[model samples]
Target: MSRPSVWAPKIVALIKGGNSSAAIAQIKVAPTVKDLQDLRKLLIAANLLKPHPNVDAATNDMIAELSAPRLHRSP
Candidate 1:
């Protein structure tokens, strides 16, 4: 993967603060769908996020994606 964006650390901080969705919203640039997905993966790998039972399938997929070794690097 390419070098992480400058916003990566900021996003991680928000996730660690337990406001992941808010972190997503804080992005200034128009990130692609995959970029947001990868941010979730980073949060998961950092053990700062978890799957909520009440969430939809897409969230569950994000949780599951981190359960596996998809990310080449840690957050």
Candidate 2:
């Protein structure tokens, strides 16, 4: 199994400390989709964020955009 990210502890600390705005700012620049997904799970688990269809749709869209193959033109 892979080790948890370093950011996980920091973000969780933020959540626990009621520093959601800082946590959200960190989340916005999460380096990977996995990070974003993990943070979302954390937020939901902490009851700081509620599940919603729009949020789900936005997550799916972000995943799609980030994972989609990029087209490269031959030089």
Candidate 3:
């Protein structure tokens, strides 16, 4: 089984405590794209963040970059 994320609880606590800036900082350094996405959802659900066009575009770009297949060069 997969291990739990280390940042989720901290982020949730920060959100609940109305510390959005700190939560955003933690989200910035989240280990995986899935973590980032999940944190974004939490922020939205808490009304701390809104889904703006620019933000969505940037997120989509990040998701694309992070999830894109890598090409291995011949050694």
Candidate 4:
């Protein structure tokens, strides 16, 4: 599991810790085109980053636990 202080957990918390309609109706939660493009670019760059062998093993173990029914689905 990811540490509570980590970015992954923070992203999950931000997206899940709210009511959908209430959040959309009462708060400005839209991402602008530029904002989305920037995020996409960042994700692409991150995906292209080299994976260390040790990190890959650890990530594989974590993903196996998370996707028990489809271990090969993830990259």
Candidate 5:
């Protein structure tokens, strides 16, 4: 778990000390798009991003396309 104190130590301290409003005011419930993009970049940099492919479905689609008959035109 990430240390809650990293972003707002004073807010965390206030919460532990039972100050609700101040803690709530200091807390960020939502991250910005930039923050999400930065996190994605970080995960990619750490090689932790694993993308899985639907191999069977892809293969079946390819086979279907390949098996479809092609029409020829006379010159």
Candidate 6:
């Protein structure tokens, strides 16, 4: 896998290990449309993402993606 693709398993392990990095970061807890798309990737890869693959992951992931301090937007 490429560097970016590898991030998925790491987050999955975090979830499987019962860690809440997002909560610790005080994530937004409710993401916007852009963050939702990002989170869907993570959750789906982690296999905790859905009964409906088309559905959004928990608001936490969305929030985490949305409100995690400052960051770059994909180009």
* lDDT measured at residue 15 in model 1 versus the true structure, 0 to 100: 57
lDDT of 2 by residue, 1-75 (tens): 997787756776776786766766665566788866776676577665553434444545666766778687578
Candidate 6, pairs of clashing residues? 29-63
Alpha carbon lDDT of each predicted model: 0.54, 0.64, 0.61, 0.34, 0.39, 0.47
lDDT, candidate 5, 1-75, per-residue tens:
753223333433454465645544433331333333343344355433343123223323444544557576578
2 or 4, which is superior by lDDT? 2
* Clashing residue pairs found in predicted model 1: none
Stretches off by above 4 angstroms in model 5 are 1-29, 51-75
Instruction: Give candidate 4's TM-score.
Output: 0.26
RMSD, candidate 1, Å: 10.1
What's the TM for model 5?
0.29
Model 4 spans with C-alpha error above 4 angstroms: 1-6, 9-44, 47-51, 69-75
lDDT (Cα, 0-100) at 53 in candidate 2: 38
Highest TM-score model number? 2
Which model is ahead, 2 or 4, in terms of TM-score? Answer: 2
- Candidate 4 residue-pair clash tally: 0
Clashing pairs in 3: none
List the candidates' TM-scores in order: 0.43, 0.55, 0.52, 0.26, 0.29, 0.33
lDDT by residue (1-75, candidate 3, tens digit) is 998676756676776786656655555555778876765676577665553434344445655666777687578
TM-score of 3: 0.52
lDDT tens readout by residue for model 4, 4-72: 223333322333454333322222332233333333244345552133233223333444444446546
Query: Tens digit of lDDT per residue, candidate 1, span 1-75?
Result: 787665556677765666746654454342444555665567567765544222223444544554566557777
Q: In model 4, what lDDT does residue 7 have? A: 33
